[model samples]
Target: MRRAIAGLLGAGLVVGALAGCAPAASDRPLVVVTTNILGDVVGELVGDQVEVMTLMRPDADPHSFEISAQEEARLRTADLLVSNGLGLEEGLQQHVDAAAAEGVPTVEAGDLITPLAYADGDAEGLDDPHLWTDPTRMVDVVAGLTDSLETALGDELDAGELAASSAAYTAELRALDAEMASAFAAIPEAQRALVTNHHVFGYLAARYDVAVIGAVVPSGTTLAAPSASDLDDLVSAIDRTGVRAIFADSSQPDRLAQVLADEAGVDVAVVDLFTESLSEPGEGAETYLQMMRTNTERIATGLSP
Candidate 1:
């Protein structure tokens, strides 16, 4: 009778252990993305395969946006963490490090793309992390992310479906590249100069054959401040380049751009572009493709003869 009771107790223990090990809500593999642009791309690539949570806001500053405590905790549950490394996510590095220390697999998109250097002047030859400004470079990002998702979450996601989604999204990015080429070609050769709020347009200018005059903030990262001489130098460059317009980020304050334009003493138009971040839904630059297209149109119009 004691042996029979012991056997029953052993069976109950096995049942309880199996029940405890059953899937819970948190069992769903989560992907914690650092920036909204990457979030949008990952969403397109993975579709409904894995749960994706982006830490940054749609229009937040990538160089300085911080995640909340709850969001940091969410990082703990993530199977994969995708970030814009190479000093882009300046304010969120500590959290990313913490998450990685906690055993979350991390992928930095900047490592995948051939990063451009800050053209001339300050921080010249420093690796610029703003690869999204060039849609073709984003092709590399998409390819790397596809492989990363597979490596990180293949057990939880369907391999075939993920590949299909990634391929389709990459095709869309290529179409965006072709569209940008056509749009920028319409601008006169002499009028292809760019003066932005900051030095965030290196990749875009490099890819499209546009000459970057100079920037208000003359550095690759936005965290750096411009001095009085810096502003004066940019104004002189703007006047010399005969740049019709100075572009500023839609998400950032454009007072500096306006100041520089005013300082230039030319009829420089201050235009806004979705340069650094994506916009909210129903807005002009809500998606990555939409952001690139919208910027291309604005740039073409701004620099047109």
Candidate 2:
């Protein structure tokens, strides 16, 4: 009995040693993405081939969301770190930079597209990081992202499958762009002006040939507070432009937009749009494509004469 017990103990020790030697990051390649929107896009592109860890939660503001220490450690170890650059991920830039410094492959979606400048507001002349607002621009981003992912994860992932998936998604984005153009074209030209909670729709406006009169907050980031003069100026523009609605981000409180609507003294409707982040499941903007489609329909309906 003593000999048998010793043999079992030796076997147990070997099993424990083997368990300790197991890979910490699992068998699949890990991709750590900063924003939920980019996370969704990467998931769509990669499917189930790799593990994708998204930092931001649904409906969370990209400008102010944070991550825990565990997440930061995982980010540094990611095979690829994807982010929306041009200062969109304000709170997480330091973490992204640290991950890049550690030699993790990094891809910024904004860096992939043709960026548009803020035509007005506190962010005037600065590159607008909201590239996904225009599906055409997003196609450019998706193409670049495909190349980056192929280069970074090709050894672990099937390059042919990755290219096929990207091509399929790119075709869908082109269809969405066409759909948006048709919808917006139906609205009268005089009503083609947009007033949002902030400078969130510059890319969209530029894409669909609409004018962005102004924003209630007068800035690109929602973290910035609107000054009294900013609101006053936007209200005047709303009155002058005769815009039918004020588009506000659904994730953000619409109180400022409501106040601007009331101050404008017009029968302006406050339309809630998924401007920054995707919504929770069944919340009507769960996916990036769904968010854009819903916003397109709402914007077309709101502006139609």
Candidate 3:
């Protein structure tokens, strides 16, 4: 009986040890991305290597989005955090700082791209934060995201997997850039002018040889409202330039665009484009490539006779 009791105790110890030392199931690292655009880019690079949670929903404005308590919890627990980082997430900085203070790895994709300075005096000495407007710049962002993911997953991820994915995605973006250039080429040079709600497409316009006559918002940021003089000047410019379309961000209210169009006395169509955010799933502009394509096509149609 004494021998049997000793054997039973030994068996219990063995079971407990085995339970503690059994091969743990491989769980992917959790990565939290602040903007939907960065989230999509990171998702493309990481693939299934990491679990990605996007804080901003589709078509949500990055400058004004508020994080919930649950989102803060997720951020706190996240192994990595990705963001645009050039004053893009205007309202979410405190939360990001909190996450950073906790020693979570964070990446700013925009830092990899060559930033353009704001042309207008309003954004004095500030570089334009909308690097995603250029496909070449997006390649830089993908590289940064790949590096961040590799750091997180290390040997668990297949060697060169991130590189392979980045190459494929970069090729697609290059093709997209070519396609956009061709589409924009179709518009008459005289009419190849854009009037957006804000100076969001300066890089894009420069790349495709389109002139940005004026913006409804006087500044690069959407938070700034256009003054009466600003509106009057824009109206005068539209009349002089004969611009056919006034494009607006789909995420923002179009009351200003409508008012400008009504006052301009020209055929000013309010073309909605995915400027700072992607559309929801199943929408035409869900992906970055899709968003660019949709916006270019709409711009072409609206500008053409």
Candidate 4:
């Protein structure tokens, strides 16, 4: 009986030791990303190597989306925090700041590319945070992000895996860039004017040789309201440009775009694009690549004669 009790105790100790040795899902290196777009990109780059927590929900506005207390606490625990900087995360800046203060490593996609300023709008001259509109720029972001993850995660992440994944995704981005260029090149030069719900396509415009006639909101962020004069100015611009379609963000209400179209009185189409946020699965833009490709097709169709 004494020997049996000792044997049972020994087995229990062995089981406890094995349980302690196996890492829990939470024990994986945590990467807390701010926007769903960046989160998708990060997931592509890292695969199953880390736990990615995307703070912004699908179709949530990055400029105004808020996080709960649980998410705020989780931010401090992040091995690395990836964000779309350049004043884009207006509502979550405080939480990002707190996470950085706690010494969590951070990589901002805005810092990876040559940021464009709002050409015209109330936010003119401010850096545009919508750099992901251009796939070539996104290739740069993936490169920078891969480097950051390798440096921050160190032995916790496999650098070899990171490089392989980045290369594959970068190739896809280059293909996407070519695809967008080809599609937009088909738009008649005279008909290459774009009017969006907001000034969210400066990077896309610059990359594709399309003109941003103006935005209904006349601001860089959807959080800004359009005044009577702003809408009046945009309406006049649309009349002069003969814009065939006005693009509105799929994540935002298109009532303003509809109003602008009604006021334009020019049989203009109100096309929806996944501008800032990814849509829910099967709603067309579950990934960053999908979002860009969908927008490319929509824009090409909208502007083509």
lDDT of 3 at 234: 96
- Tens-place lDDT per residue, model 1, 1-305, is 99999999999999999999988775568999999999999999888778899998988999999877899898987889999898889899999988899889999999998788776657888889888988888889989998998999878988899889988988998888889888888899899998887888888888888898888888876788999998888877877788999999998899988988887898999999998899999889899888988899999999998
The residue-by-residue lDDT of candidate 4 on 96-180, one tens digit each, is 9988988999999999988988777788899999999988899899999999999999999988888999999999999999999
Question: Against the unseen true structure, what C-alpha lDDT does each candidate score?
Answer: 0.88, 0.92, 0.87, 0.93
Judged by TM-score, which candidate is best? Answer: 2
Give me the overall lDDT of model 2.
0.92
Candidate 1 residue pairs in backbone clash = none
Question: Residue by residue across 1-305, what tens digits does model 3's lDDT show?
Answer: 99999999999999999999999854878899999888888788778987889999998988889989999998988888998987889889899999999988888876888788777737756878888888878877887778877886677676487889889999998998889889989998998998999888877887889888889996878888898999999999999999888999999999999999999998788989899999998777898888888888899999998
Model 4: how far is 229 from its true place, Å?
A: 1.3
* Tens digit of per-residue lDDT, candidate 2, span 1-305: 99999999999999999999987757899999998888999999999999999999999999999999999999998999999999999999999998899899999988887788988888999999988899999899889989999999878999989999999999999999999999988899989999898899988888899998988888999999998999888888988888999999999999999988999999999999999999999998999899999999999989998
Worst window of 10 by summed lDDT in candidate 1: 114-123
Off by over 4 Å in 3: 1-26
